[model samples]
Target: MADFGEILESIGDFGLFQKLLLFALCFPNLILPFQLSSLVFNHADTNHHCNADWILQVGPNLTKEEQLNLTLPRLPDGSFDPCKMYVPMDWDLSAIREYGLNETTTCTDGWVHNDTIYDATIVTDFDLVCENTNIFRAAQTIFFAGVLVGAVLFGPFSESFGRKRATQIPMVLMLIFTVVTGLSPNFYVYLASQFIVGVALGGFRINSIILATEWIGVAQRSYAACLSQVLAALGQVMFLAVVYFVRDWRIDQFIMAGPLGFIVVYIWFIPESARWLLYRGKTTDAKELIQKAAAINKRTVPDSLLDKALEEKPVEKGGIKMLFASRVLRKYFLTITFAWCAVNLAYYSLSLNVGKFGLNIFLNQLIFGLSEIPVHFFCMWSLEAAGRKLSLMGALIVGGVLCLLTLAVPQSNYVAIATLATCGRFLMNGAGSICYVYFQELFPTAIRQTATGLGSTASRAASMLSPVVNMLEIYHFTIPTVVIGSLALASGIMAFLLPETRRTELPDSTEEAEGKRGPKLSNPATRDCEDIQATKL
Candidate 1:
């Protein structure tokens, strides 16, 4: 039987139809970074001190500086304590000044935030500072938890339904929840809406790649994967621009949600995945879509070729269990999934806590976003040149080493810390970009979405922990860096065990995916012709 790849070649491996589909699927990728990284902006740190307005009754004539000096305690650093204030007394302002306040307590009133950088953030609006800081981190954790849930649920949902449906539904849900998130009356409402948005984000992120890659040829899979990220990186840059100008989390949320409305409308035009259709035993629908694609690409698929594709039997539906049945698959599954977790743990830890670098948050985020475009582009080449395993391993180990190197730098030297972090982010992103192609190629089509979803679930689980790990910096500055770097190093070592799938056809069945069979070759004639052409050149 002609496998789906053979049919893709006959009709158009990367012809107009495939290009159109790839373009459409990748467009939505631009908006995802807004949700993923928005926390950095939405909960940005603001200069604040405890509100001590009650003292104003007695100190009505006191200047602003005088009020703070008299009402708030100073830390050993000589800065006014942000979380504490002097207990109020019945004495007059003159007597209070002479005696001085003896005891301190937590902020009795609200926080007074200096919103010069951000006019408003979830932090300032909800007063998620000092004792309430963990609540902001918890909001991030909740969002990633939603992503984890979405991965488990949407993976199978896409497998059962068509990929187009999976993609479309999430776009709508993302839009709705994002709007709700902007209008949230309280912190609890914001958390709930963000969680739903996270769920939708998880579904769209997974299925978009699967739907695009299922139509693309094996040769272009790296390009298909990395290009989506390139656009996402650009989106990060653009979102930074939006955040820079808007400066309010609510308006930012509404602006981010605006693009999705158009995406939801246009996505309906894209067809369902032919590979998915065939996998579901809807061969007729698969054949029809293929024919339409072939026509659109200005090519004609042979009747025999189409008939052979139809003759291939549908895969059994056993969900994730199918991945564990084979010993070889189990090893691949474990190795790749752990690698996914480690990379995300490192990536998001730095990504979420950009403020810790002590640089201008906008400039810091801009540099971070700008860096990914080149790194991902380089990754596209490295995947083809150095091969998947070597590329992933090199990026991870090197990135981890850079991450560890930060321990020697003083936190007060924000410039030095930001420099090392930028370098670390550059390499970590490369490792992450490689995983997208690596994961898709490792599993058979029968369980590809399931495996991808589960891998993403592991990554999201890491992302959930990433915020908590960042919180550990409160105990000791070195803790977050140590944990992140250690995991990257460990996972880099784990990458040594993964089989190289460079220049190989994607496996289509359990038999093909097992043992050494996972790295199945392309058509002998085509490969030979390419080799011969290379020799002649």
Candidate 2:
């Protein structure tokens, strides 16, 4: 029987229709960075100090600057400390300058904040500064915790309910919650919204990638995986530009939500995955989508293609049980789970920590997004050349080493640290992109989304821990680097333990998946050659 790949070949795999699908799917990918790191700009730090300075007693009329100068200790950066103030006592206005008021204490009065750059952020609005900072960081932790739950939910949802519901529900909810987050009047409301948005985005993020991927043939899988991320990078660039114009976090949220929310309208156009439909015993629905694919791509559907796809009866229902059923699969499952966790931990840690390198945050974010573009492009090509295992392993090891090298660079040199950090980002981006394609390849069609969702859960767990790792800088600066670097190094070594999947067909059954050794020759699918050649035009 000709499997789905041959059937896809008969119906013009990756032709005009697929390109159109890619453009439509790119919306979620584009808006992802806005939700993912909206706080980076939305909670931007502002200059602040204790209110009712001791100098106010010196004279009824003193400039805000003079009050701050006389009352606050200077930070290492030449800025006045926001958390501490001089003791208020009787003093002569004329002799105040001569008085040695070296005594100081933590701010007893409310703070006076200065916002020269950002008009408002959660930090300014709610005063998420000083001791309240951890609660603010907890917003992200709460968000990732929501994502962790989402990853567990979406994969199984997509498998049981079909991809369209799994995807579109999250798409709409993510948009709604993002706007609500902006409008939230207090920290708790804002954190609740952040958590829901994270939940919605987690489902949309993993399931959408799998939905489109399952439709394409083996030959296009490598580039298809990164295409999703390239669209995300494009969104991040646009997000940086948007932040420059919209300084208020609340207004920024509305801007990101309004236009991209239109994606919800396009949901009607998104076809159900025919493969997933067939796996769930909906052969009639599968054939209908197949026919639509043929008409849109301007090709004839092979007769009885759905019948061929159904020849190897799939397990009636797909779930996490399949992931642990076989020793080989269980090992692959554990190894890739760790790899995904390490990749996300390293990626989020560096991204959130970019402000510490003393570069402009917007510029650093723009450059970081730009720097990782080449890695995706490289993955687009290298997935075929280096193959999945070598490429994934190389990215983890090299990215890990580059990050560790940061410890050797002097703190005074922001440029060197930023450069090495960007390079590490590049490698991790490669690993992450490769793993998206590679993990899906490791499973059969019936259980693929389930396994992917489970993997997403583990990665979210890592992301939840990442902020705490980033926070370790206060205790010891090197601790974060050591933790992230060691995970990456260990994950890279684990990559060697998995079988290589180069030009191999997506497994049709769990038994078939377990039967094969990992490495396969990097050969073009000759079955797909004529169709792919036609696609070149």
Candidate number achieving the greatest TM-score relative to the actual structure: 1
**How many steric overlaps are in each model, in order?**
0, 0
What is the Cα root-mean-square deviation between model 2 and the actual structure? 4.6
Candidate 2, residue 330: CA error in Å? 0.5
lDDT (Cα, 0-100) at 162 in candidate 2: 83
Global lDDT of model 1: 0.88
Compose the digit string of candidate 2's lDDT tens values, residues 377-419: 8888899888899998999999999999999999889989999
Model 1 off-target regions past 4 Å? 312-314, 515-537
lDDT of all predictions: 0.88, 0.81
Against the correct fold, how does model 1 do in TM-score? 0.95
Residue pairs clashing in model 1 are none
